[model samples]
Target: MNEKVVVIYSGGMDSFTVLNRALKDGKQVYALSFDYGQRHVKELACAAKVCEELNVPHKVVDISAINQLLAGSSLTDDIEIPEGHYEEESMKSTVVPNRNMILLSLAVGYAVSVEASQVYYGAHSGDHAIYPDCRPEFVLKMNDVCKIANYDAVEIFSPYLEVSKTAILTDGLAMGLDYSNTWTCYNGREHACGKCGACVERLEAFRDNNTTDPLTYE
Candidate 1:
């Protein structure tokens, strides 16, 4: 690819894989993470660390306004993050409505500012079951909307959208992604609760991929 790629990173297993995948393929990477007033500022901080460690240009956008607008989720509020397996019941509590859309919109703007035409994300199909915004149809629609909304110069690419967490983990391992450097807990604490929806998903991904999590959890 001749054009540069900017990633919408969240410092979770998914976005870390997306960032690594782009870099492994020799794409010039500019990692974009958000300080969106989320409950877990730890994840954003992790994103900054990983970006620096990987020698990628990383910028944090202040989107507290957007988070304020969408505040029903446990990820952004005092509500407890659901624990257990990543199933329909457990995942629903973690959904921040239209979160991917807002994140991608900001990422597209950044990509355009940097003269980059492609933006990458890690919205996979497993998440689609819980997050309405991560679905293929929603991504396609948002891509079209962003193309027009972004002066037709910006495009979004979701490389893992059709796969499972196990599949994305396979790519992450190959790209040498430091799992310890990334954070996934929805709880805003010093340690992984090891029980939140995201934590559960991460554990399952590691198990499914026959990998191990390096982070210490309670």
Candidate 2:
């Protein structure tokens, strides 16, 4: 039997790439999405659609109330999401405190319930500078914690940890993944706000790869 892996899928370019990679690796995939009351709940819809197309079982765990308590971050609150490259200092406002930790904790539990051996999420080098939870150290420590917390030994796998967004896009492209089905804008609109940090990074990635982003932007 192929090992089962649960993907913390957000229906963004990076997470969608992770999902496709797992499928290509012959793993039984279960997609896990969170409704954390983020401004970009639009990604959840895209996530479901992608899962449907892939014929993967998908579940959306509601932790939307976290937005009520963790209210300062731009993603979960009223603060304006900054526009610019992801390397900009202002983009730090977009970091939700302990977001990956919280999500991974929930994902680990789900993995255990499903008797899965691994949980995959997309936290690439691009996110390390601004988001503490996305750094390699955090992933290593979290994997250690998972080992101690679970009897069945679930592993946290981030294949893109040191990879660039452009490299991820290249991989997805090779797999024939449809980038149009993914959503990356933070604005939660019908069209992507091309100015937001997420959009900017995504656009740059495609441009660097000499390809066009399929999603229309405003």
Candidate 3:
């Protein structure tokens, strides 16, 4: 049997790229998404669509139990979503506090269930200051931690950890990813709140890459 690779896919540009990379490398891809009381389910829906399009196995883990542990975040709360480009300061509240850790650990468990040794996440350097979990060092440490915790030789993969969001966008484009199918809003609003940190960052990256965005932005 070919090696199986699982991804912490959120149906975003970075996660989309990670999925492509795993598939292109001849691994059977399994995507793990969460319905973790997020402000919106659009991203998880998009994640399902992407997995179907790729003919990969998709798992929608109900992490609402864990999500309840989240507090003071626009993503999981009733707080207003902040709109702005990702800078050093404004992106702070966007942190879900160990969210990536929780998601990745869950993904690792899923991978082990299917005898997969590799797990992938789409965290990038662009998220370092804002999401501590996305930093390269954090990923490295998590890899080590998972190795010891699982004792099953599971290795975590993060292809974009040292790269920029623009690079992820570029890679997704090269892989023929239909970004129109992805959602990045902090709010589960009617339209892409073009002001949220994610939307703004995505818009800027696509623009910087001179790539046309497929998402509807107002």
Candidate 4:
């Protein structure tokens, strides 16, 4: 039997690539998504659609009940989503409080339940500046905690932890992945707002690769 791996898929470009990478590596993948009341459900929908196309087992865990506790960010609160490059300080408003840790904890629990030895997420270097939870130090410490958190000892695997968004996109494009199935805009609009930080980074990735983004934008 192939090794079982649980991928924390968010239906965004980064996680989409991670999900396909697991399959490409010959692992039995369980794609896990969360409904954390991020102001939009399009990413979850995108995740489900991609998983369906790949015939991967996908589960959308409803954790929206905790949205109140995780509020304050533009993603979960009434604050306006920031626009422009992600490196700008204003983009900090978009960071959901302890979001990655919460997601990783749940993914680890799911991994244990499924007897999967690994849990993959899409925390990349680009996020380290704006999102504290995606930083290398956090990942390393969380990895340590995950090791002894339970007897099963599931590993927190993040292949793009140190790579840039451009590199991630490169890998996905190399794998012949169609990015239209992914969602990156911070808002839950019918068309991607090309001005938001998330969209900027994603567009930059495609531009850096000298390819056009398949997703339409406003």
Tens-digit lDDT string for candidate 1 (83-190): 776665866878878788878888888888888878998889777778888889999998888788856578889999999988888887876677888888888788
The per-model lDDT (C-alpha) reads 0.84, 0.93, 0.83, 0.93
lDDT of 3 by residue, 1-218 (tens): 77888888887767878888888788888888888888867888888988888789898988787756788777787777776766747668777878888888888888889989999888887888688788888899999998888759788888888989898888878877777888887777778878888888888899998977887767
Per-residue C-alpha lDDT of model 4 across residues 1-218, encoded as one tens digit per residue: 99999999999999999999999999999999999888767999999999999999999999988886876888888899988988999999998888889999999999999999999989999998889999999999999999999999988999999999999999999999999999999999999999999999999999999999999998
Q: Worst 10-residue stretch by lDDT in candidate 4?
A: 67-76
Native-referenced Cα lDDT, model 3: 0.83
TM-scores of all predicted structures = 0.93, 0.98, 0.95, 0.98
* Candidate 3 minimal-lDDT segment of 10 residues: 82-91
- Evaluate model 1: give its TM-score: 0.93
Q: How does residue 214 of candidate 1 score in lDDT? A: 93
lDDT of 2 by residue, 55-115 (tens): 9999998998777667689998889989998889999899898899999999999999999
Clashing pairs in 1: none
